[model samples]
Target chain A: MAHTPFERIWDRHVVKDYGDGRSLVFIDRHFLQEATSGRAFDRLRAENLPVRRPDLTVGTIDHSISTLPGRTLHSFAAGVARNVAMHKNCADFGVRLFSIDSPHHGIVHVAGPNLGFAIPGSTYVCGDSHTASCGGVGAWAWGIGTSEVMQVLATQSLILRKPRTMRATFNGRLSKGVYAKDMILALIGRYGIEAGVGHTVQYAGPAISALSVEGRMTVANMSIEFGARGGLVGADDTTFEYLHGRELAPKGAEWDRAVADWRRLYDLGDAMFDREIEIDCSTLGPQVSWGTTPQDVIGVNETIPDPSSIADPTRKAMTERAIDYVGLTPGTPIAGTPIDVAFIGSCTNGRLSDLEAAAAIAKGRKVAPHVKALVVPGAAHVKAAAEAAGLDKIFIEAGFEWREAGCSMCVAAGGDIVPPGQRSMSTSNRNFEGRQGPGSRTHLASPAMVAAAAIAGCIADVRTMMH
Target chain B: MEKFTVLTGVAAPIAMPNISTDLIAPSHFPGKKPEEAIVMSFKDKLFANLRYFPDGTPKPDFVLDSPRYQGARILLTGENFGCGSSRETAVWSLQEAGIACVIAPSFGDIFHDNSFQNGFLPLRVPADDIDRLTKGLARTNASELTVDLEKRELRVSGMAPIAFDLPDNRRIPLMEGLDQLRFMLRSADDIAAYENRASTERPWSFAAAGG
Candidate 1:
């Protein structure tokens, strides 16, 4: 019987099946960040359980670190102590850590993949919802909670029930200004957020194949937003090309062998999936979230949905609450909605290509006087590459603050936040209540869309500014 | 983790959909030290935004604040409760606030997994059962409900008992207060054998940690 990519990878990782629904699955790589790993490490020490495999684990400082210029350990007083705790924990546990001063330090999800730690046909785990971003390389990656993190630290294995499989095929060619961010948002908007629950989604078809590795990461990063624990894109020539010369990637003869093995990681023609859905990308427009939930999204040309028109009582109530919280009227058009801030960075869209796309729009243009715009690279290497490509100057000249690498503004940590009751155009994944800060409303969009909105001082269509 | 074989207590209703973990445990809590927040009891921080004013006074209108549901141990809410973010702090806060079970049509996948690890029951009953329970509680002014894990039954004041399904693996752990890590460690030999075989089969996976 032919097996799908998810099945093949999952079957390879099972150490033992308990005859019940649970199975002991092996974890290939584990990435840790400051905020979630401190308690897990403390617990490990308290229990006198040594890390099962220190070589398979790596840590980075990202979640709570400041992104301001000349940032030091003491830049953010609240985060300083946590950073100290993380350093001590990682040192005591014999795990390699990329501290705040390290050149490789960045968001774990971003830096892990960029460093070639997430290889094809491997299993990766992190204590972050966006760990699925590493699945761009065809790895079986998912996020876990703190307790599960402790489990990984002590045992390097987790007892997990196999999830059902779903194949989401994006067919047809993407239109200009429409991107992976738009594609994923359109999917969540059409299908409710719970559509991917109880399943691992495999993103396939022509559109997925055409996306760059970074673009694929952007789509997979939001898998948690739609309630999926994991999402993967099968490895191909494009994936191998992206991994070829990366730091932790296999060397010479080993690289050739790795590539040959990765080539077999795709699904066979007769592979089976529990559920399948196809989405057409030819007619898709740039997407922007208008409400708290990612499912509450619309195309750039569409208007905000009215709660009264919704039939389901639960949906109607949710919509009404979202609209009230976001401070938007039911029938108002989403395009002209004013925004007080424009942020372009996160694990979702903080890569080099994302910065280039945003910079392309910001070049030869000035941000509207009222909008406070900033661009934060996802990783230190990404920051260096963007600066080498002259993207930083373009953004700075366009009135967008070019900041250090971190998860700035996206999580409202390290003192970077959108003020209360103000609206922001952000490239981050979640737009839940006070996600960016207390009472701060966020509109999720692509990096290019955020750049256009920053220039226009409102939610604007990126296509209009293109060319 | 506490054992949760059975629970009988007041169930409060909050009829909002997609109650994200961010709402349950906000990232920013004034006057709380960041480093100590993780180990501290989040009882007062549960639903801080919705439950408190800017000046730090409790909002009396919030469901958990209402005098009738002050000690509620079960939460009856809409679909997709505990959605967004994999922060286990959300479960910790709810547990600290005296909530032992949450009855919703569905829950976020990560949050569901986190609940099992903490011995908290995230029960998924049909929408009709929730509707019936809400109406029954309102009509009779009897908010007490019993969740019997052994029988897999939910009993309310006036309605017929509703049966729910939980996997045996998850159910057994919660019933016995078993430590999953300790249990998995018992099979260390199996894990070692698997790893050795995997290293030979996929040598690329064990390559150096850094570039």
Candidate 2:
């Protein structure tokens, strides 16, 4: 029987079905970070079980490790003990770990794909919401809670209820300075935050086909923000090109065989979807979240929505509360909103291309005198590559701090938070109230948008600086 | 994990949508090591943003602060409660604060899974039922509500009981208090056979770490 790409992959991994909707799905790779894995590991020990497939599980310290250059684990303010616990637990369980000192250590989602652990037509699970980033390679990856993490560690499988499929096709061409971030933000802005609830979103169409693997990762990474189960972009020449010769990717004659199989993972023309959305990307501009949620977004040229004009009472209340917390006036243009900081990092936008794009804008320019700006690479290798390409030098000369790799400033748990009452233009995913700090307001945008905002000390359209 | 067949307690209502984990347990320790902090610190941080003023004094208008809802073991919240972040601390903080069950129209995926693993019931009922329960508990001035998982009904004073459905796989665990990992391990042979087949079919996945 013909099946969608998602069903083919999901069906291939199902170990056993319990007669209900639930099935024990095989996990190809299990990635772990310090913050979420400690409890799962502890629970495994409490049950007197070892990591069932230690060879397939890899641990790293991303969430609880400091991104300060030349910093040690002991220097991590809040995550020191947790980082220590991770090392101890991983060591005891014989799970391979990329420590803070390891050059490969970074965000689990970034490290997984960067190291080629995320193979096409496979499944990856992490106790992280951004695990969908691996879907850029046509893998079906999603986040699990600590308990599911424990279950996977104990049995190398997960009991999952199949989610309905939703196809979101982005057609036409993206405008100059618009990006995958803009594409997703615009989609979320049009469709409310809960648009993808109970569904796995398949991204296709001409616009998605044009995206680089890194860009696809950026789009897939934010699936959780809009409440999607996960997001997938099918593998093609671009996918294989990105995976070829990567550290953990297939090699030798096996590479040819792997490519042949991955080629068949594309969706059939008549693939069915429970729901579908077709987006025209031609008119989309640089999207920035105006309020707390990702759905509360507007184009760079647009104004904040007035609560009174909003039709939904719940959404209106949310808008009012967001305006109050963000200290923004309703109906005012968002472009000139003053910002105290600019951040370009996170699993979403911290890839090498993100750094290169931001650096291109930063070259021969300076950050606003009063504004603090930072550039944290998504992975240690990305930082090293940026340094080799002199992107780090460009950022530093522009007064943006080029830091080491980790999930810095994204989760705001590593002491990289913006000050209270200060506003920030960030390339990270979430913008919930106080997500960055106690009273810090976050405006989400692309790397170039963040760079432009840093230079202007206010939210600015990346298109204005594109040329 | 405590076996939960039934629970009776006052249900504090917070009818705000997208009540994220950050709000449930504000991630604001500010250089304080979480591993070093006392258990009470997590309890103190529960609902800190809405429950307290900037000076750390309890807010008078907060639902959890009301004397009538003191010791509430069930929470009646709006849609998408426990969204944002994969922090298990959100569930831990609520559990520490004596919330044994969360009744909502829906929940964030990870939070729903985390709640069950932590022995907390995250019951999903129809939106109308949730609204009716919230209004009924208020109108009747009912201090106690009963969640009968075995009967799949929520009983309150002077109101018709509302039925809720829990999938059998999840329901069985709650009734037996079985650890999910141990339960999963029961299918070890099937898992092994599947992996053996998968590795043969897709050997790239089992290649050496970073090759």
Candidate 3:
């Protein structure tokens, strides 16, 4: 039967049936991060279970390594130890690990695709929740839990319940300033984050067609925010081009063969979809999360949100709770809420491009005094590549801390905490209350936007930072 | 690294619903290095106060470090335990604290898998059965409950049995101390065969050739 990339990947990795509700999927590729796998590796030795399929897995340290300029092993000792442990765990499991020293190492999400670990018509799993990022390459990738980590380590298979399917189509061209992130945030706004619970979503449309691979990754990575099982895109020229010559990609005549096969990974003319959402991206923009959830958001030009304006009681209640906690009021514009901190990295948008964008904004501009900002490199290689171009120095000269490559404030790990009651703008995927630190309010934005916020000490339009 | 222990007990006794992983282990750590920075991120940032971070104050609504269950072994929780992000650290932190198993009406899909693989028996019991234990605790103001991991049964002291769902594949693996990663690594020969074949069939797949 003809199939889309999602269907092809699904069929190849299916191992068993768990009734109609669920099926067993054999993992084709597995990725591990420092935060999740450290203990899991220890568990395997304790249980005497070897991390099987070491050849199918890879590791990279991103979360705790600082993004500060002149990031040295001697400076961030705790973070350095985590990277060391990640390297150790990968070695123990026989999975290839990319360390701080590896030029290829960066955010695992970006690193995996850049290294071509995520292939068309395949299955992938990662210890990181944003493993969905692999979907950008047309793979059926999903995040796994620690216990699942143990299971994957032992068997490289997962018994997964089939999530209901949703086909979200983005037709029409996206207007300027509107991004894939804005498109997703807008979709979630229409269908609350939980709308797609227990379902897989297919991003199809002219708008999706227009997105860069990184933008597609941004779209898919937020699938979890809406509680979806996963998100996927069909393979096309864009997909193949991104994979072309990647460090771990197919080479020479074999590359031609691979492309020929990948080109076929798209929906047949009469393909079926369980549900559909058509979004006109002509009005999307620099989106900002206004409330606690990804769904609770507004366009960058909108206000802080008036809970009373929402019709749904649940939404209203949620907004009320968020407004009370975030210290925002109705009729107050969200674009200038005043931030005390600003961050520009995470699995969602912490790519080299993101750093470049943020640095462009901070190149000659200075960070606001009250805003203690940090520009974290999602991966070590990203750190190095940026520094090779002296991006780190620009951030530091502008008062931004260039720290290690581990997940920092975005996850609250490695002592990366934003003080409570402090409002800040971040580029991470989630803006859940206290997700950064206890009572620390986070408003998610793009890297450039985050840099703009750092400069203004509050939410500001990226377009305004053009100078 | 010091070894984590499993608590041997008779029955489960948590009373809340939707015991999320954020409560078990939040997604504070997402990178490969930086283990130390992550482990202590929420040590004092109790579940209740996760909403008020950076203030370093507890909201008191979180249950991770509540006084009521200070020394409890079997975590009898509400439905959908670990229902959040797929953070394995949650399982590690719980296991490190000697929580051998978590008995709830349901568990988050990823968390359940992580828990089982990490040697944490996430027992899925009926809501009614869980209610019975909750009521018993409420009446007696007691929270101590035991779960027998080997038998896959939950029995309160002097109380009748409370049945729980156990993934069939997990039975022997948990008992024999096996996990998917470990199992594959053990069958290096089989994995190598698959890798070699995958490379030959799809020579373009770098991961296959690298393996």
**Per-model C-alpha RMSD:** 1.7, 1.8, 5.5
Task: Tell the DockQ for candidate 3.
Answer: 0.27
Tens-digit per-residue lDDT, B1-211, candidate 1? 6788989999999988888988898786533444444345678778876776534456678998787897999999988998888889899899989899999999999999999888899999888889988888887666899999999999887788889988788888999988887799898999999989999988878845752
Residue pairs with backbone overlap in model 1? A247-B211, A248-B211
Each model's DockQ score? 0.62, 0.52, 0.27
Over A213-235, each residue of candidate 3 has an lDDT whose tens digit, in order, gives 88898888888776675888877
What's the lDDT of the predicted structure labeled candidate 2?
Answer: 0.85
Q: What interface-residue Cα RMSD does candidate 3 give after superposition?
A: 5.0
Worst 10 residues of 2 chain B by lDDT: B30-39
Per-residue lDDT of model 2, residues B1-211, tens digit only: 7999889999988878888887777766433333433234678788776775434456679988788899999998888888877778888898888989998888887788788887888898877898888888888666689999899899999899988899888887898898776677789888878878888988877744541
**lDDT (tens digit, per residue) of candidate 2 on A177-235:** 98999999988888877888788899998999999999999999988887885889999
- Candidates 2 and 3 compared: the better one by lDDT is 2
lDDT of each model, Cα atoms only? 0.88, 0.85, 0.70
Interface RMSD of each: 2.2, 2.4, 5.0
Error of 3 at A428 (Å): 0.6
- Those runs of model 3 whose alpha carbons end farther than 4 Å from true positions after fitting are A1-4, A15-24, A46-51, A72-74, A91-94, A307-317, A359-364, A380-398, A464-467, B1-20, B26-84, B92-108, B116-200, B206-211
Please tell me which predicted candidate would have the highest DockQ against the true structure: 1
Model 2 DockQ class: medium
Please give fnat for model 3.
0.40
- After superposition, which runs of candidate 1 have C-alpha atoms over 4 Å from their true positions? B30-41, B53-58
Ranking by DockQ: 1, 2, 3
